[model samples]
Target: MSNALELLKTRASPKAADLVPPGPNEAQLNEILTIAARVPDHGKMVPWRFIVHPHETRAPLVEKLIANFRAGKPNANDAEAEKQRLRFTNSPLIVTVVSKTSPNPKVPDIEQLLSAGAASMNLLNAAHALGFGANWLTGWAAFDKSSKELFGLADNEQIVGFIHIGTAKGEVFQRPRPDLSQIVSKR
Candidate 1:
C-alpha cells in the first residue's frame, strides 16, 4: 500500500507545451506508446486511437492547419494566425488521442470518451515516468471539422486531446491539488 501510495504522491505532470525538441527517439517513443495502449477498454473495442506528428514533418501540417483556419476566419491578424500555426509545429512530438464514438447502447458515448481520456492521461504519465515532459492540450482545432478531416478521423471519431511530449525547456511548477473532501461523496 505504501509503495503504491508513494508513487501517487510523487507523480508530477509537467507542462507539455513547454517541452522542447530532442525528445525520446523513435524507438523509445514507440515503446512508451505501446505501454500507454494497455488501458481499460470496455468490450475490447479499442475505441481510442493515437496519431504522432513528428518534429521533422510538423511544419507542413501546421501550415495546413493555419491555412484551414484562415479559410474560416480570413480576417485574423498575424499574432492570432501564428498562434494557430505554432500549436502543431511547436512541440517536438505531438500525439493526438482520438475518441471513437460508437452506437453501442449498453456502453454510452460518455464512457467511450472517458476511456479515450484515460488513454491520454496514461500516455502522459507513461512519458513522465520515463523521464520526459507531456502536456495535453486542445483548442479550436480539436473540435474544428476541417482539422478533424485533415487528421483523417472517421465520421464517428472525435479528438479527445492533442498531447505534446518532449524535454522540459523551462521550470515545471506543481500546482496544489484540490481537497478530496470537496469532490468525494459518502454513500
Candidate 2:
C-alpha cells in the first residue's frame, strides 16, 4: 500500500493524558501548521484561525478557566473540575481552531464553518503523520462565552476544536470503526 494510504489507515486519536512531553520543535510545529492550512476552502474564504498555547501560557490560562468554571457552577463535582483541568494541562501544546465567517454575497456561514472543520482535521492528520500524539477536543469551555473570551475569541466566533499535541507515552488504542457497508451507499 502507498505511504499516504497507510498513514490514513493508522490515523487515530489517543487520549490526551497518554501524550507526553518532547512535543514538536519549533520547526516541526511550523511545518505542521503550514500543512494544516492547506484544505478545501470553498470560495477561497479562509474562515479559520489557530491559537497556539505554549507551556508557559497554558498554565495560567487554564487556571483562570478552571476558576471561572468552578465559580459559575456551585454543584460541579471534583470529577468535572479535574476533567477540565486535564483537558488543558495534559498536552504540552494546545492549538485552538477558531471558526469565523465573514459577510460574503455568495458564500454562507455553513460552508465557512465546514472549512474550519477541514482545517482542524488537517491539523490532526499533520500532527499524527509527524509522529506526535494528537487529539481534537471540545467541551463546555468551547461554548462558554466567558471561556472563549479567555482565548480572545469574539462572541461571533466559535471554536471548532482544541488540538492537543505531544509525544506518545503509552499504548495507543484502536477503537472500533464504523461499518462502511452500512454507512456508504453507491448512488
Candidate 3:
C-alpha cells in the first residue's frame, strides 16, 4: 500500500510507556508542526496556539501535576503520581494545543474550536506519518482553570489536548473500531 494509505490504515496511538526516545528531530518537528497548522480555519481566524513543552519542563510539570492532583484528591496514591510522571516524561516532546476562541462576528467560537481540534488531529497524523508515535491526551490538568499560568495559557484560552510525540518502543496493535453501519445514518 501507499505510504499515505498505510498511515491512514495503521495509525494507532501507542501508550506513553511504549513511546520512547528518538522522536522527530528539529527538521522533522518543524515539518510536523507546519502540517499541524494546515487545518481548516474558518474566516482566516487562526484561533489556536501550540505550546511546545521541552523535555526539561517535563519534571516541573509533573511536580505541579502531582501537587494539583493531591490537592484535589487527598486520597490519591503513589501509583497515580507515578502515572502522571510517566505521562509527562515518557515522550520526548509535548505540544499542548490551546483553543483561543476569539470574539469574531463572522466566525463563531464553535468553528474556531473545531479548527483547534482539527489541528490536534493533524498533529497526531503528521507525527504518525513521520514515523513517530503520537498520542492526544487530556486530563484534569487540562481543565484546571487555576493552573492556566502553569501551562502559559490566557484567560480566553482552553487546552484542546496535550499531544505527546516520541518513538514507539516496540509496535502498536490495532484495536476495535466502530462499524460504519452503527455510526452512519441515511438522510
Candidate 4:
C-alpha cells in the first residue's frame, strides 16, 4: 500500500489521559494548522477557526471550566468538578475548533458545518502524521453556553471539538473496526 494509505489505515487516537508531553513545537504546530485549514470550503466561507490553548492557559482554563461546571450543575460533587478540571489540563496542546456558522445565501449551514468537521479531521490526521498522539473530544464544556462564553467564543460560534495533542505514554493498541462488507452498499 502507498504511504498515505498506510498512514490512514494505521492512525489511531490515544486516550487523552494516557497522552504525555512533547507536543508539537511552534513550527510543527504551524504546519499542522496549515494542513488543518486545507479543507473543502464551499463558497469560500471559511466558517471555521482554531483556538490554541497553550500550556500557560491550561490552569486558568481549567479553573474557568470548573466554575462553569459548578454554575451549570449546582449540586456537582468534588469528583465531578475534578473530572472537568482534568479535561483541560490533560494534554500538552489543546486546539479548540470553533464553527462560526452564519446565515449565508450561497452556502447552506449544513455544508459549512461539514467543512468544519473536515477541518477537525484534517487536524487529527496532521498531528498523527507529525508523530504525535491526538484525540478529538467534546464533553460538557463543548455544549455548555457558559463554558463557550468563557472560552471567548462568539455568539454565532460553537465548539466542534477540542483536539488534544501530546506524546503517547505507550504503544496504542488497534481497536475493532467495522468491516467494509458490513457497512458498504452498492446502489
TM-scores of all models?
A: 0.91, 0.95, 0.93, 0.97
What are the per-residue Cα lDDT tens digits for candidate 3 across 44-137?
Answer: 8889989887676677777887787777778889898778777788788899999998888999989999999999999999999888999899
Q: In model 4, what are the clashing residue pairs, if there are any?
A: none
lDDT of 1 by residue, 1-187 (tens): 8965665566665665578877889888888788778888877778899998889988878888888889888899889998777767767888999999788877888888888998998888778767788888988889899999999999999999998888888777878998999999999
Candidate 2 Cα deviation (angstroms), residue 173 = 0.8
Steric collisions counted per model: 2, 0, 0, 0
Looking at candidate 2, the ten consecutive residues that score lowest on lDDT are 147-156
Which residue ranges in model 1 land beyond 4 Å of their true spot?
Answer: 1-7
- TM match of model 2 to true structure: 0.95
lDDT by residue for model 2 over 5-94, one digit each (tens)? 999889989898878898899999999899889997878878999999986678888899998789778699999998889888989899
* Deviation (Å) of 170 in candidate 4: 0.6
Comparing 1 and 2 by lDDT, which wins?
Answer: 2
Candidate 3 TM-score versus the reference: 0.93
The residue pairs that clash in candidate 2, if any, are: none
* Regions more than 4 Å wrong, model 4: none
Consecutive 10-residue window with the lowest summed lDDT within model 3? 144-153
Greater-lDDT candidate between 3 and 4: 4
Model 4 collision count: 0
Candidate with maximal TM-score: 4
- Model 2 CA deviation exceeding 4 Å by range: none
* Residue 126 displacement (Å), model 2: 0.6
Pairing residues by index, what is the TM-score of model 4? 0.97
